[model samples]
Target: MKIQLLVLFLSTVISAFKITDGTLKSSKQELGFFESDSLRLNSTEENLSVSFKIKSNTKPNQIFVKLTNENGIESSFKPTTKKSGESYISKLSLPFTKLPTLFQASSKLFVSLVIASEEDKYFETVGSIENTPYLISKSTYKPTEKFQAKPEIHHIFNEAPQTVDPSIAVVFSFLSIMTFFTLIVSWGFNGALNFGNFKFDLSHFAFIALIIGYEVTFFFYYLGDSIFTTIGRVAILTGPTVWFGSRLLNYLGELRVAGQR
Candidate 1:
């Protein structure tokens, strides 16, 4: 009778072990509960406190708490656990700096408790706490003032482009005029201004007019006309200027030759 009882006791213990082991291996088994009230914010240590429980039958090789911010940033934390009667209580102090910096007081973070079991080759997400408020005191941010007309934005535009000083402009203009007159006087003294060989014809006047037109074109270019436009105008005048200038020079050459003879 004593030997029979001993064998039955051994069989009962073996069956219990098999059942517990099977439960640990099964992914469908419910893990445990999370105490939301157990969540704490430690400002001094700069860490967040989180607590959760796991089944007593299983001893997990690792336990992790994952936090996901609104922006999809994820952070994982490993917790130190303690063994309770029917469950293992796990708590972790995650550094606040480890969380996503964009987290605000109004922001919600998805919390997940994951466990890796020695009996199982894969990790399992057992429990989750959804829409956990970002509880850190510093998470509160000052919003912009609302419902009031904003201060009129006085745009500080850049000043308009300035030209040379009036005095300097005047001085340069006087110098240029004096240079022009000096050049004419020098030409007259050198007999270069003599119009004896000059012909009062359409070609001569046209050549002179084209030369003045070139000066006018340059003046307009300096006053902000597009370089392409100036170039186009100059090109149109080039053919006429060339023809008239060639004819005037040939006529002068003939006149000079005749005078020399």
Candidate 2:
């Protein structure tokens, strides 16, 4: 007996509630609620139609449909049923000519359904499914403009390359020969006298200074715009400059020893 009663109670609960369905269609899909479009506004009267379907097991005493804006202003419509049963179709028309103040601003619109019975009241909120319509006195956007391009330019020749300079190459070749001759002289003098004193002189300092200046200037020019360029130029220049500078120092030592003798 209790199982039968439970089944009957569950059936009655399910039968009491209803599901509402909504679909949006319009003469113009891209039309903004507040923007002027191909759809002609009758200053005398403007109408918007919303159609919906309601499915319920039991009959409702009153059905109320309302449209609300973003500002919470509501426009109410009481639908009169044309057909019997749970399915329904209704039209709502808003007259702008009668209430010009309502159309003054761009506003969002929402649709809600309210059903009332002797024992229960059911409320369902529907729409706002469309984009907020813009209200404009005039269209302000124009369609003609071109875009511009800016490119970065680098001066390649004005800045030294990441390789050794030809002028420095000649200087380095002279320095290498001078070093070999000086080493030969030092070995000869030490073998004969059994004692040798080698000293670096002013000419050696001048050679080193010139190489240093060249290196510094080369790096500064290479780094004109990029750090990677500076590092590469420095590495290339430093190797040759050190090799030649050491050779120039040894040659100066040989010169000083000959002068002392």
Candidate 3:
């Protein structure tokens, strides 16, 4: 019996050394989330009770419990702590309602201890406990339960645009053509086609080209192009057209004033 006790003592010392890098250092510190059935789950109260132990020289300032499920949901809570001789005992009561809704039997519970030494602050993870069997069996509701297939969706689209009567379109086209010809005839009779007073320079030529481009852009706009496209094109031409048109008008006015003089 003495030999057996000595062997057990050597095994415990070996295990402790292995955990602390083969050193008999009591300053290495130790922490544990469970020790011989320290965890309790109250089904009626819907609360989980956890007791963890930490052995450290420095007094801890805070104790936290972290719960994580297989679905990756996590929850954290602060626990109460009490000094037990040379070590500290921290206990937490976590409510089911306070935990993540997806937490299940496959969830894990982790405990952490935080210590502050002068200006230095550090935290240590005690350990993790997994395979919470009572989480599902004791629960009345399943928050992570799957549902059946969803209802089919039907889409509604706008009706296609209707076309105008071919006869009416033809009549309108004829009237448009006649009005264009009539305007040209009136302009010609009024000598509007005469460019004798206009300058034979870059400004005059650019002004005429820009005017024709502006008119053609509107004609295409009436034909099929979207309003936004036409507006963007018009905006591009507006600045240059205004500059050249202004120069042409001033030159023409100067020429008229010189003739009057």
Candidate 4:
């Protein structure tokens, strides 16, 4: 029995706890809707862990942690701490199930701190000193109860997002290539910086405008949260073109006037 106990002790896993190296934040979620706002406990080391501690001037007799999951399930925990000042502080250890699930449909994790603010040092039932809820991560947590799937989580993000307008991409690429060539060509005729010559000035401005136009369109289309309508996209594209085109025409008129002079 002693030898077996020795072997078990040697085989036991010990977590290497360290202070946070980076800003404490939760892991990325496969589901877009859920995000974690839970105060971080420990560094994100080999083992998953998180904790929260709060200090204030007010000392309350008691402090409590309230957690809510996507299913609207709620649970409360009392933190262990010694009074530092006027406020009672609660330090906490987080469980996995109280966090948002990776593949699960639940939207977010919420946690709040409840404290007593009354002169009697008794916590009020309503509007008791409560902290804003936190969002939790389920990456390392497991719940006592099995999680059931919600249809909406799967259904809403399931449909494939529409592909970006190919024509827009082609046009953007073409404009970039043309802008490069135009700069090279314009720079050849009128040195790299030639403000006196309106033609070269227009070429420079046109290149900048064209690049901006493409970037704005791509930014909107590529963003996951934003839905870029075809009309909205087309509208954004038109701005730079009109601006660049007008500059070109103005440059020509300037050249004609200079030639006459």
Q: What are the C-alpha RMSDs, in order, of all predicted structures?
A: 18.6, 18.3, 20.9, 29.6
Candidate number with greatest TM-score: 1
**Candidate 1 lDDT score relative to the true structure:** 0.59
Q: lDDT for every model?
A: 0.59, 0.53, 0.57, 0.45
Error of 2 at 260 (Å): 99
Query: Mind giving the per-residue lDDT tens digits that candidate 1 earns over 28-81?
Result: 122233223223332323445556666647767766766655445556778887
Tell me which residue pairs clash in candidate 3.
none
> Candidate 3 on 9-122: residue-level lDDT in tens?
232221111111111001122233323232333343445555655565545554455554433344667767676776666666655555554554544543333434453343
> Clash number for every model?
0, 2, 0, 12
lDDT of 4: 0.45
Task: Name the runs in model 4 displaced over 4 angstroms.
Answer: 1-59, 85-88, 97-105, 117-261
Query: Which of candidates 1 and 3 reaches a greater TM-score?
Result: 1
Ranking by TM-score: 1, 2, 3, 4
TM-score of 3: 0.31
Question: Against the hidden reference, what TM-scores do the models get?
Answer: 0.35, 0.34, 0.31, 0.25
TM-score: the better of candidates 2 and 3: 2
Tens-digit lDDT string for candidate 2 (163-232): 8888999999999999999998998877863434434565556666767766776668766747767667
What is candidate 1's TM-score against the reference?
Answer: 0.35
Which portions of model 3 show Cα errors greater than 4 Å? 1-164, 190-192, 216-232
